[model samples]
Target: MKKRGSGILCHITSLPSPFGIGDFGAGAYEFADFLSEAKQSYWQILPLNPTNKRYFDSPFSSLSSCAGNTALISPQLLAAEGLLTQMEVEDHPHFPERRVDYPAVSRFKRQLFQRAHIRFQKGGVPEDYARFCRGNSMWLEDHALFTAISDHLGNLPLAEWPQELSNRSSEKVQLLREELWDEVEREKFLQYLFFKQWHLLKNYCNGKGIRIIGEFPMFMNYDAVDIWANPELFKVDEQKKPYLLAGSPADAFSAEGQLFNCAVYDWDGLRRNGFNWWIRRFHYLFRQYDFVRIDHFQGLTSCWEVPVGEQNGLRGNWQKVPTQEFFNTMLQHYPLFPVIAEDLGTIGADVRETMARYAIPGMKVILFGFQKEARERSYLPHLHPLNSVAYTGTHDTDTVTGWYQGAGDEERLELYRYLGRRVENGVNWELIRLALMSVAHTAVIQMQDVLGAGEESRMNRPGKAEGNWEWRIPTADLGEVASRLSEMTACYGRAQD
Candidate 1:
């Protein structure tokens, strides 16, 4: 990140695929090749953590932070590895080309996964599979048990389960584990497949000089395995329900406030435990990716804690944590903490100080630069600091063209004035150019913006519940701008070799 470089922000789910959702398959390698051709140095993606349909499959709200979304396991890759037959891989529904049908995809993949598991069982487990299970046992065993029990009980929440299992009584758990041995092993097998395919793709990207930048969400879903397995690490009540939820305090965004319904961390308990959970989580993430973006970075210093059952975010209070001690411990574990801070929202001075002290790069989304209150000069291209990562917009924001289309006259005039010229090359390209030319050492653009895609191509809408995270790129459109992007990258001194 020290040298001038540029990357694209496209999640795995957004990549083109015939499996209804992107995965670690041929399309991923093709995207890597495209990135290399376009002179990109980084391939940033959202959290690959396991997602559940209950939360509309949001990546941020995951079943296990240490686990990968099995839905991303490519059937094609499985067939190539001889686990799935070629005919079985090709036999599928007519999936939507531009959007993911999560439920449909889930149903389809579950069958394929079962078949693969059965085939593997018939052939006997390989040494590598055994090694993967053993190496990831810390989280793998508990997660598998949690998943197996949930399935056995018809997807009931942990709190609603029988007391013996819910409380994780060692005797009852061991008994249940024996009973659900097949189910537990199936879950572990799925993880093995997800990791095997993922590392292969990561290696391909690295071999092409493209570094993978993954994300780590600050909070965990209340129903996640982490909360159920490690109750002491969270602020859960007697019923195992979260006493406080994670969210933002009432401000300009909402008068009442927001409730994320996510579990809040027990900061004191974490510190007492030497932040072992967090250190392990980082170790898990760093092993797969070159860099990791710490989402909701301000939470490291202080978080807005809203009491559970609150109708709105009004009752939330800022709770501070041992920021210095936490990072100190993290540094002790990792001598080089390669992280990008998602300092997008209302961040405090303490958070900023910690980021600066640790030399962690913060984000500079150009979309926010034109907003009324956020028209800070630092957000402008000419004023971006060298230590920040510049972007046309993030996954949560609209595409560059979408924002430009909806911009008020005043905002448009302001943007034009900042550019000091007319909009000749499309607005998306103009912003992309701005990002590339900015003093920021790293510039990351959304794939949507690269094709001048509009609102329909936006990856996500923050407050809206559904119809988001469904956008996908077409294979043909990927190479359309390679030459132009490569030219601009070289012109801006961002091209590698």
Candidate 2:
């Protein structure tokens, strides 16, 4: 593992915002400045992709891995780019000022991106658009067509579509391509605009020495273009319904384990093709960011396979994975890229062994450390692997302040004992300091923990489907925390050493 540096785990949506969701505009520039001031090297975000109604609420549940979330786009940037005028963005519509009301934000932002797309289409293409489209053709064409068709599907399942269309028959697809060519072309142009703006934003962060850490979920949404296009990779029946699905076992979030209905990959088929699907996904993602964190990292070793139509993972069984082959293939192709193993919750020894063999760093969440076994046990920082990444808490876990507020006396005492101190006023900060001081190579503090905020700042609560991922931060500056964190990073030698 490389000598890790300090970073912050702030989902892009939680950055300073009044726009319901954060975007790669002024707020992003501001964050880059903060990261530079804080001497932090990384800004970790959840997946950046297009999503559906239920899942757009949680970035973890996105529709397409390749398509950028049209929602996170900044209208202000569109204006600055000559695609829109201030007259439009300022007076377009009134949106919620506090947490992200995604639906409303989506509607407003879509119209803006649409207008921007129109302007770009009518006008000649920019140099960046030419570069991005040329570079991303590996997935962009298919993804753009998928977006166009999905919207045309109008919430109808693929099975119900006309047979030719449903099967993606060559003749019908060719016809649809010709008929919907304008829409498809415009959609492709929209993605091009998104990538162009996103690249500019990324360059600003990189210039400030801020590297982004991004997450890639193992399974994608059923309505995604990937599944609709290549149902062969999944355990889907002829009708394209999933035979078996993905999820985790029962835990604090739910007595019934989560039943993520997305189909599990066909390991044999994946191997036959040399996991080309995964290769493209990783290749495209690496081109966009500094590091990729595989969510549910244990799934690569062994996944909890839930039977389709099952309400929960209660009856799911542990299924073996072609772990060695899957990872060995990726490592062969992209040996230089870094991957963080999100090894949390009921991990098996094989998972740890796999991570060690591959030199991939796993995670240690401090909030989970509140448990009896986590402290004075191997899960604690003292016993953690030097190649691991330590977090005060994660997006799904409660914020440290929220944890302290909700945990019982025994739990608090456990934390106190571990830290060798009585609980104090700023318990969250204390935990952050501990994480910074831990032996793990990388230390990441969540935005909520930095604010010492309570449950309200919590990004998601796992099992609770809706009302998660909607917690957007106010347009508050992070200057104070940035200065304080810089001092702490310097003190801990976590500054880019």
Candidate 3:
């Protein structure tokens, strides 16, 4: 039997707030309240990790894959935690309320989190804090220590740091650990506040029956503390240079193909501990979210490995992956792990077979479904297949309204035939109707589409670099979007208790 639901796909950082970007504070609660009123069951977000300054192509490619983006750590919540006063937080550099100025927000939030760290140091650690440290010692210690060293020495790439630290010599590591104990403590404290605030927000959503859709990216970024800290796990040489980075061959989207230079894993290194690292990752995520969405599910089936010196993503080659055995071993240890497979882009039969074997549902995108070229676009709602998570559009695509207006006459006409109705008027609502009426058990729509927003509300453009993950929906849009979507939820039989 299928468990049906209607969900909102807005990353937590996109939640409306007075601060530069949304944080896991009141904005989270308000969003959850809105979702409950709208009868939505899932709250999907992008990978929650510290981002590099490039304002890079995606949140999927992020530093600190396991840690929450310190940028999203709510300053308002800090005030509530007594780390800052309301006025101090309000005085935060007058940031544009609508978009995230990453640099500006990073400086201001760092200072605020520093204050929280100071307070934690002065107050001394709590028992729960110690327990959290002990419980998460494996990743937490390395991440916290990496953050401290990175901050103190300036955020240089791990490769460029002093040889002792960069290569992580046992003697050097021990010496540095003793020398920089205080800094490590401070970083850990910052993470504690983030975890504290985030869990509180997650609990609120859970109380309202909203399960978070936390993301799990396929690989870790080079600048990440994790990659440097666990050098053996990736295909990196003794100098920390990548042995074989990952990317995809030329496809419909990019004629040159997709070059994902992120570090690929060394299965032998992982196999030694019986994939204990992977198990630990899922365990931490399972505690934070009810369901985990594995980004680039295809990577696990068969990865495309690019030589380190490749000029563009175009020259990568596809290599067979051992994901079948990996999943088999992983599930044997942790069974009831609910996951959603992102089977977008060029996928192969092995990918579907793997997902089907595990009973993990794949994703169906609605924006990709609609088009005037009847034979061209397969994203139209009428073509949706069951056993998948459906979306009006993903974080990468333009909102429904944007897709409609930007599409040519034939594209719109094709949509008309697909929906058996005029494509010209109320395109957003019509698409929503088709999504709800489909065989998909779970349907998700970006908050942008809920308000009939256009291109500017788009989350990320696949190849474009900047001005992504910046759009914010006005808080006032919450009530109307919730109610309007609730009506659709009821009509679609996805209304939750």
Candidate 4:
């Protein structure tokens, strides 16, 4: 992280695979090999948490902060472990090649997991599974039980469940635990497979000198296991419903501001407990990633809190938090904290001061540099600070080619003038070259940008809820892309060799 390097921003779900979605399978290994051949020092990915498809299927809005996504469990790996037969592995529906069919993938994987679980039950569980369960009992047990109960009750939110179950009173919890013990174990088995496969893939990448940059959202969804398991830690009413919601003030991206629909934290309660929960969370994430990117780092200094019933974030107020104390406590526990601050939105002096004091690298996006205002020059590569991570565009942004296509004539001309050229090469690669050659310590480009993809391959749209996080790369283009990226890495002195 201290050296000048570059990487690609591609989520695990974006990896090419024969299954409906990507997994910790051959696609993952092939990507690692491609990165190695390209001399890439890092492979940045979104959060690996299990996404709630019933929600928006956004990685940030996950069911559990600690649990891995079972959708990423490799069926081939399962066959290798003798839990699934070759025929079973080969017998799957024909999924779309360019996009993920989440619902279909969920159904297919769930049935396969059931078969694997039955086989494991008959053959006796492995000692490794027992050790993993014991080691992660702190969060795993509660998450497994919560998932089992949610399934049993037909996926109802905890608040809608029976009062005794919702409150998780000792007697009700014990009774349900006994009744749903098998279901809980089944959930645990799924997580065990996920981690087992993930570790193997991570080891493969690390062996190739590729470090993973994992994402961590600042706030938790109201329906997540974290809030459900620890209701006392959030701004909830007597009945455990949220009193205030998390969001941002009106910005260029949204006239009414973004309604995140996440629960605001009870800062006082968390401070009273010495922020041990966050400390544990960081411990888990650091073990899983070489560098953790704290999404919405500005929220740590202050947050925009809106009334729970508000239609939008226009009526929200900014409240300062105990940012310094929280970070200090976290550092006391884990001194060598390697983190990147996603300081993208409106930031105050205090936030900048905190990040500077901690020496944490902030972010610069080239897509934001073409604004009509001169004050926005910081996003330009020439103005980027040395201790920052630069990107052509983030997953939340349109692909470079897409942005160029959608831009007005004036904006396109301005972009060309800024680059001191007029479409000499593809806009995507031109922007990528700018990022790689910048003074920032690290540069990352989205996979779509590297492939010169257009709007059809866009990963997300900020205001839109559906039709996002579905983009996937085609397997046939990896070789050519790797060769081009390797040349670029060497030209910019970012090559590892």
User: Could you tell me the lDDT of residue 461 within candidate 4?
Assistant: 78
Per-model TM-score on C-alpha atoms: 0.97, 0.95, 0.95, 0.97
**What overall lDDT goes with each candidate model?**
0.88, 0.78, 0.78, 0.86
Per-residue C-alpha lDDT of model 1 across residues 379-442, encoded as one tens digit per residue = 8888888999999999878788887888788888888888887674499989999999999999
* Error of model 3, residue 412, in angstroms: 0.5
Candidate number with greatest lDDT: 1
| Candidate 4 total steric clashes | 0
TM-score of 4: 0.97
> Cα lDDT of model 4 overall?
0.86
lDDT of 4 at 472: 93
Candidate 3 lDDT over residue span 46-110, tens digit each: 88776777445357776775677767778877788787878878886677866777778777877
Off by over 4 Å in 2: 372-376
**Candidate 4 residue-wise lDDT, 123-152, digit = tens:** 886799999999999899989998898898
Cα lDDT, model 1, residue 154: 88
> How big is the RMSD of model 3?
2.0
